[model samples]
Target: MARWRIWRPRSRAVPFLSLLLLAPLVFTGLKAVNKIGLSSERNYSRGHVTFVTVFTTYNSDPAEASKLPSNVVTVGKHSYSKVGRSMAILNTFIGFIQVSMPRSNVIILTDPNSKLTHGSAVILPIEGNYSRGNLMLQRIRSYIAFLEQRLEELETVEDINHLIFTDSDIAVVTDLGHIFEMYPHCHLALTFRNNKGQPLNSGFVAVRGTRDGIFKAIEFFKEVLEAYHLKYMEASRMLGDQLALAWVVKSYLPSAFSKFSKHEAFTVYNWTPPEGAGQFHGMPLDVK
Candidate 1:
């Protein structure tokens, strides 16, 4: 089980609270623009990036979807009909990726029963169940299993440089092959949201394919899994993966993960708009 301890200052209680109040401001200023190591001496090539996402097809009817095995149902809080819409969106996502990065690898982890096809993308079937009640933990477990399988294959495969795990609906506007080269030291990259409830968004995660990078990612996921199981706090279970990830970052490995901002070369944004509110913000034209 994952365990954490908080240290409280006995000598200066008021000062600690004051620092806590000011910590956010300090953190914001420090992380607003991180430009260290931007210009590296080594010239790296455009490496291959493998993009992976979890996708499962379901009937448009809720009743029919419910009849399917619990393991095969869509993992999120969306309705069966909405999940059907997501299937369509994922097809478009795959198409954009193929057009943008023709040489990149796109893999989908879906249920074994899914007959849906994605063009030029490798489909791998997942094992075990994903309960709606524990959606975040179950999703993390599935991703962990997938990473483990890939780690074994990485021993002989040298072509893949980075492994990017994204939500099924995420679209690739351009080739992301430069991310790994830009942030060579980034073993794991996590995107932060403005919301306090769940600050760390797990929808987009990138991990280096090197031996050390994969091991660090697995360790991080294992920590989150253990924290979820141990019920680290009420919010950890209530808010799901994001809260659990926040807790892990707070208690341990604070500097282990790279937190990217929109000012950087590439950053993933939370592009969730209201239903039927089609206001979309495409990638910045200046992004290279």
Candidate 2:
């Protein structure tokens, strides 16, 4: 009788074939898992975000004759004053943009003496006394102080994830939600340069709602203003509000915030209208 040997597939061969078939499956499964994990992580991190814009206006210039859209709040003069008109125009633009964007919350800050309409915008009155001197500088100082005070008040009332400050003269051209998506961890975002290549206009700034290092910035501004006795274009240049703001960022909050270039999204400058697309120039109309 011929010796009968049971022929079995080589154990090594079976294992090798199994691995060959499973290799693609294993890789595909890992890729899917990774994708799901990343998606979940992104969604989880995207917490509730609120958008805010603040404008400071004083009732001085008559150029404030323009009109803003309904959503904007013109906070300065309240009684058809130049500041009111300017703020009105400004608020109009802001209201238009806010309506166009639909997701942002807009507020207008004005002197307590302002007579702004109730529904036009959230009107925040300046609370403390502003010492008389260097009118423009004093106004800027008071505005900044008002902003700080308002921020504190907001914190007390609700949770704010971020705050963006924009001068009435800058136009918004794009949805800024992408910015948050790009730099989710950043505490502040600001425009560093204008379309004309001018350097450092604090016309636009974005800051986290936390008050952690904000007081330091305020202190720096106070020091600059006091030391320079900022007044007049030349004297103000020595320590202008924008310059003081820049100094604070450089000296105190460099790493605490991030700045974006204006060329990236929008344009801001002294508006010379009938000439181009920029905020209106002069008082009242520009204040909104």
Candidate 3:
């Protein structure tokens, strides 16, 4: 038997059903933003990700840090590194890939300096300083903040296979043409850190473009954010997104990620205590 009386066509109940179907538009007046035409969104190639390399710099100003040596200065390191990273990416071109803000889905989660435009490249607006926590805490918060925004963007866009999220500190010296390869079976792809059979490191993450994978990524980050707020995790130890990610993967998503070596992925400059100091670093991917 039907859960309720099944109304025949053109019955009194029919009108009420129609109203419920259109309720979202009638009540909320949601104007969906669809500036990108069919060619970009619908057409092109299916199963191929429309690559959108991401960059975020909040409370990351290198000008002040310039006063101190690169190694000693910890604050706003990615901002200064952004100089090289942005340039390297610009110099190298990848087919079917266009780095843009409007399409990439960047939000002003916090206040920041730097104009939206930089010569031919685009920085894309300044907002959100992320001043709620200390400098170290700020990065952890940003890790969550950026994902929340990016996941939202990916959800709307159709057929985006994977989202390549790289830190502003990461620069591309060689051509990233190899990313063109298909990922039919992979859910998540990333580089740096062996993780000892664990998935850690948030510097660069390639989230599986599928809705399920992205949803998992969002949930994982939410856990990190929640831990930060509740003071469950030690702030001093959890400076970057690494520790948070380690916790999330160990506790969840243990089998979801696939790791690539630094040689296969990118390089880190100004790393280690002696020279790069692990502070000012670069990630130049190996492209054959």
Candidate 4:
């Protein structure tokens, strides 16, 4: 009679044990369904008109340029061959992006001596003579000038609203359509590395094409360059373009720059692999 009692209890508990085991599986299935629904909603919310630009010299190597994804626009030097295989790779990358994102635009700025064919991109000849010694600074200045020209060119068109600037070395693995959703109020968005708890990178940035805040930031960068005499020959080299950009925006318009909290948003991937693989990676294309 005691053995019979034990078997009776075990039979009763079997159903309870089975339910407990199945509870987690049921919850996991519902959670996955919820995630799929949310992902679909986010996809519908993606913006359509986003602009991306890259400033490259004629000397950039093709191998480095080939790594750029298909969503970027290439701004190259006048003589395509002079810029070397790197610029050619850049041109090819931009071509791919142009095909993928049909609504996007690519502009290449080159000197009068450039031999590049004007294909799908708008070719803007370098306005004045500038030396290669101050090429980095000059490239920044020319890019701003190119922005103004492109904005004017698109004045009649209402589709383009945001501008994204990326260095040639950066690569995009995910679709960046979400960035356009953060524009206008979020005048500027860029990735930065934590410099011992401070933001330190500026390889990638997004700006509202119509915002005056960017103009103010650019002027501040110019002042810093001029004040330092555009020469970093000193032991304490005046901050590079990225540092200068961060300081100018943080100092002048704190409200404008959106600092990325996660290190993966904009980072030096050479030292450490990005915590998340899909975001973006800013690699150094140059040897230095």
Candidate 5:
């Protein structure tokens, strides 16, 4: 019973369109997809930031992960890793930043009773109750915003300047302190595609959490959600968040839910996946 609104493209080639997607400005369980907030001023000192905000959502509980699994959880072979996923990312992402942003705040959205060997990990719960969003892509669409908005609920958003949002699997070999400087302009920064020209990897994305930056991210997932209502798209598409994310950013239709023209409103990072293919471009990124 979602509401419908008409979105007419400025171009004449695109006729009329109405999407039956009603994104609530306020969500209950996990914060709603469109309820973005902007403070009048930053909470922390901007220049030469000593503390950085970093968070990642991890639902390792078998019951939770089974509900919605990412490409990393499903095929499990995307990243160049052996013996499943290693703990290298935790050390690299948080450890490497100590050189510049020493007091980095690392929050992981995981199950309630999870244990951690890393003394620095701050544990938060990632609820698996995604309604009918049991599919992986649906999980990605629902949770990406949850991760962003949860920060707002904690009241710690304004206290931090740049949010270095990254996936738990990404292994950082070099110091990426400079990438945060793009917050003023890029809003969100991440690798655009892989050498094979795949879609944007949802694994790692840096959102600026400003008036427009966080708004774009939460709204971006709202658009990806339009695919869930399509009778043609399969549940398997949900296996990877990137495919759904790509479609949400580029899709154009009177019945579709994309907001901007192409991807003009994004900042592509320099890092690309070690390997991948573009066979799924313009379509859902899935294994079929």
Candidate 6:
């Protein structure tokens, strides 16, 4: 009878075909497990996230108006004696935020004279010229200051690790804590509008809490502030904050910023909504 022998592979260093095939399955399985864990509230923690927004009070006081920046003074604009629409919207925004992300911290950067108060949100007084052109610059400054302060505080305290700055009009429909896990390497995330002329919508910005991330964020904002102050052209100031942000990201930090998805930037109007977009009558997807 002929002797039967098992065939042996020439190279033992090569991985087994079975193991190679299983590698992808194992990786995919691990990814699915991580996604499930992140979605579960019991497994995920939201204490590390802090939401920030600026609520500029409509100050009619002559004294406060006097503090306007030189650019505002040059424009000769009247004080907004009657301004309530945005505030009403902001209050509604806060209500949604409180209900959706109760565990996360919310900080409202408002004028010292702002009467708007919230039970859960921390009202941080940001002193600056809240004029149309100057407001954007001040907002950037406020973010920088807050980041710097938090970095200092983080030396001893370690409760927070991410800061999400958004426009007051944006309403939260769900907890955004999953973003950190989803974009593990993202240091800064900015929402983009479809318009190429003014691509970056400063409506939402997410900053990581690492020292490098904070510094990069600060640097980028400082460049934005400088652009506003310099006013490359008279039109630069008139084009609004979005243009300035786009210019900064393109010119200074093209690779430094990541983008939020269409779902995250689902606005009520202005830009075209994505397919199967749900009704935002109650601020459901303002900034998810």
Question: lDDT tens digits, residues 39-87, model 4?
Answer: 1223211444344443435434434444545445444322323344455
- Cα miss at 13, model 5 (Å)? 20
Candidate 5 on 1-288: residue-level lDDT in tens?
222223333322222222212121111112112321222233232432222222322333322332333444324344422212334445565664443344445665543344333566665555444333444443454356554665575465444444555555443433344544423455444344322223455565555545454555555455555554452255544433555555553464333333322323222233333235322222111100
lDDT of 5 at 246: 53
Writing each residue's lDDT as its tens digit, candidate 3 over 21-87 gives 0000001112232332222233221344433333333434434432434534232444325434443
Name the lDDT of candidate 1: 0.57
Residue lDDT tens for model 6, 63-178: 34335444342212343222333444666777776666666678988778756565767888877766666676667778878877777877787654777888887656666666
Return whichever of 2 and 4 wins on TM-score. 4
How do the predictions measure up, each by TM-score?
0.66, 0.51, 0.46, 0.52, 0.50, 0.64
Please provide, for model 1 over 1-288, each residue's C-alpha lDDT reduced to its tens digit, 9 standing for 90 to 100. 111112222211111110010010112111221221222222242556788887665423323433444445343454334544566577778876766666667888865655656556888878655444444565687788888987888887765567878887766665655656755655666655556666667787777777776766787788777777676445443466777777766564353233322233323334343233453333233221
Off by over 4 Å in 4: 1-84, 95-102, 118-120, 128-131, 150-159, 194-200, 211-239, 252-288
State each model's CA lDDT, in order.
Answer: 0.57, 0.41, 0.38, 0.41, 0.41, 0.55
User: What is the clash count for each candidate, in the order shown?
Assistant: 0, 12, 22, 11, 2, 0
**Model 6 misplaced regions, further than 4 Å:** 1-47, 60-84, 232-239, 252-287
Q: RMSD in Å for candidate 6, one decimal? A: 15.3
